[model samples]
Target: MSPGDEHDSFGGVGGSGQTRTRLPEGNSGDVYGGARRPVRSSRSLLAVVGVVVLLVAAIAFANRGGGDPADAAGTSPRKGAPAGDPTAATGVRPVKAKTGTIPTGYAHDEQGAQSAASNYAVALGSDGMFTAGPREDIVRATHDPAVADDLVKRLDASYSADFLTSIGLDENGTAPSGLTFVSRTVPVGAKVLDYTETSATVEVWCTGLLGLAGAGSTKPVTSAWFTLTEKLTWTGGDWRITSSSQTEGPTPVNGDNRASMADEIAAAVEGYGGFTYAR
Candidate 1:
């Protein structure tokens, strides 16, 4: 109900089951018989609130079993690679440059794999991918060239106008005027489960923010926990992502914090930029 009280809605992308039918472009009154409808009664409002709380709890519980998926038995590659001692000279700095503001130059060894996985998570969760130019840079920097090419086409198709409108954002992922949309990935920890000279796999556990800030907003910024599993390979002397996947969180309960106003929330996002998370 308030700005900072977004703990319940922050990470959710859609209402459980709400649909809206469109009216013809210039059809005044055709949409709803040109009549205003009565607001929900107090009892109905109470029931809705109760159901929302229950749904949030259910979602939190459901996201806990986050290891590998059921179908990953044979399809997923084997976990962590055989132990091989790696020293700093070559392995330590495979990918360590800035492709602009974004991190690039991922190594082609174990450490490289870990760095690639973590940074890739950041790129995947970023606001940049909502727009065209930065989105392409992200894909090219994080993924293998071949994969990047294919993904760019698919990503362009995926972030279409309809998709943007459905999620309360414009085609570029910007919220409406006076609104601030938030999306980011913060890496909490990472581990290299398996690795070889040319390819490696790493898992990163991350927390993220996904929501919109604005007055009278029904959706507020929320938190989510998701693990990113990345399959990477050595190419052009650095680790490049070949593929990756994400599953919902091992999410925790919300802390008791007073909610802020929508304007305040939007201002905070505008004033603060994200960090290059580590460890």
Candidate 2:
């Protein structure tokens, strides 16, 4: 077995226009797009964010009234909660800088905290956490320097070799031939549990897909609902996760949508890219 254990991951922003194109008649090249699913990649995964998804947690926002945006430049909390709509984009550009593939350099305020929590949750829940190198980069990027090393160690133990095998992945966290392992966290909403000038606690309610996507696979990808709570501090001019935990949903009943086939799920992950939310 390769030497390594534990896990960590987290970040993002932006939406670019996608134009739909109709396929021209072709015998093979574009016919059913060659009838082959696109390759699976861990770098692109999707999540939808909303304030309403938190259920009762939405009401617990910091009740403080307005204050100066300039005041937030220091370690003091910004005046008032984030704008009227919790889901509305702040018009500020999402963080474009990245540590490895994780987004960084978020604004030092509420939107930053919320974006950090949501993106970190996605990273923590990604298939990369099942591997080592990418996992370490994710942990270090999302966490405070003081705790990042410890977190990397703890996470290594959490994603043990046995755990990896039980989930139909190799020791390196790669799925068997022709199979795709999917583990993605989609943040449904973010809510401020508490906030200070230099620190904040945010809950990111999320839905995720996990398991293997391929025929003959023992573990078929499955969906889950939960909330990821992150304690964040303004560190190095950006929000870094100080500590984190998770709890069961806030889940809603599944509507009429039927579960897609393994190939279909794999295709969707490939066709649709993820977002770097900045609300």
Candidate 3:
């Protein structure tokens, strides 16, 4: 698969296919060694062999229990096989500073660029994007100054009143009194496509929620997956977006879980605040 085509398997979400083991038939002695003993049936012989195998396995495990199991394969269980792989967190603390709830003051490294890209994806795809003031704030805070003004103007034009109304929002970008409009993007992971001290290109795989949540709401909330590519520059001691683009997903198959009720979804969104992701 191409680099952009990579997707998360949503590990253990789907049912596993059952596997059947074919046990050997006939006398055990025929396979193991000499003639069969006079008294024991083949079934009994097989049972004894099973027990012996179990005992041997148990002894081996006991011997191996003294050291880290992952060490046997020369890998860190916490970080996966390749230490530098981007999917694994580097254990570095994330930026503590923020400019209007969006993270800022990244480390001026590839990891920092990646963190900026992921957090920017969250801000750009958030419910805040529906409104003018917050959307402008987000773009200004995350984007490089050279393109920030132009981006804000274009985004303002794009999120028009008609567009908002079609998605079950008012001209002011608010939902009806009893309803909640939800839009949230959560980065599954990030990878650096290209990197240097001054510039980096990063891709964030994201899943999002969009639509209206309430009884009788026409646009019931649903999930979507997409990938965002951010071209970043390390400027003034922090990484900032020069430009970004999004494409439909490299999404995995959907899980079998039942969709939550509108009330449940709204409540969850209200209760959960987003995170400041770091690589």
Global lDDT scores for all candidate models: 0.51, 0.55, 0.56
Q: 227-246 in candidate 2: lDDT tens per residue? A: 57788889788898776655
lDDT of 1: 0.51
True lDDT of residue 255, candidate 2? 41
The residue-by-residue lDDT of candidate 1 on 56-144, one tens digit each, is: 22223222233323222222323664442332233243445766555667555566577667666766666666677877787687677
User: Which runs of model 1 end up more than 4 angstroms from their true locations?
Assistant: 1-95
Candidate 2 segments whose C-alpha is farther than 4 A from its true place = 1-85
TM of each candidate vs. truth: 0.65, 0.70, 0.69
Position 44, candidate 1: lDDT: 16
What order do you get sorting by TM-score, best first?
A: 2, 3, 1
Error of 1 at 110 (Å): 2.1
| Candidate 3 off by > 4 Å | 1-91
lDDT of 3 by residue, 200-264 (tens): 98877665656577888766665444567778887777898776555545444443355677788
Give the 10-residue window scoring lowest on summed lDDT in candidate 3. Answer: 6-15
Compute the lDDT of residue 65 as modeled in candidate 3. 21
Q: 42 in model 2: Cα distance from truth in Å?
A: 26
Alpha-carbon shift of residue 35 in model 3 (angstroms): 60
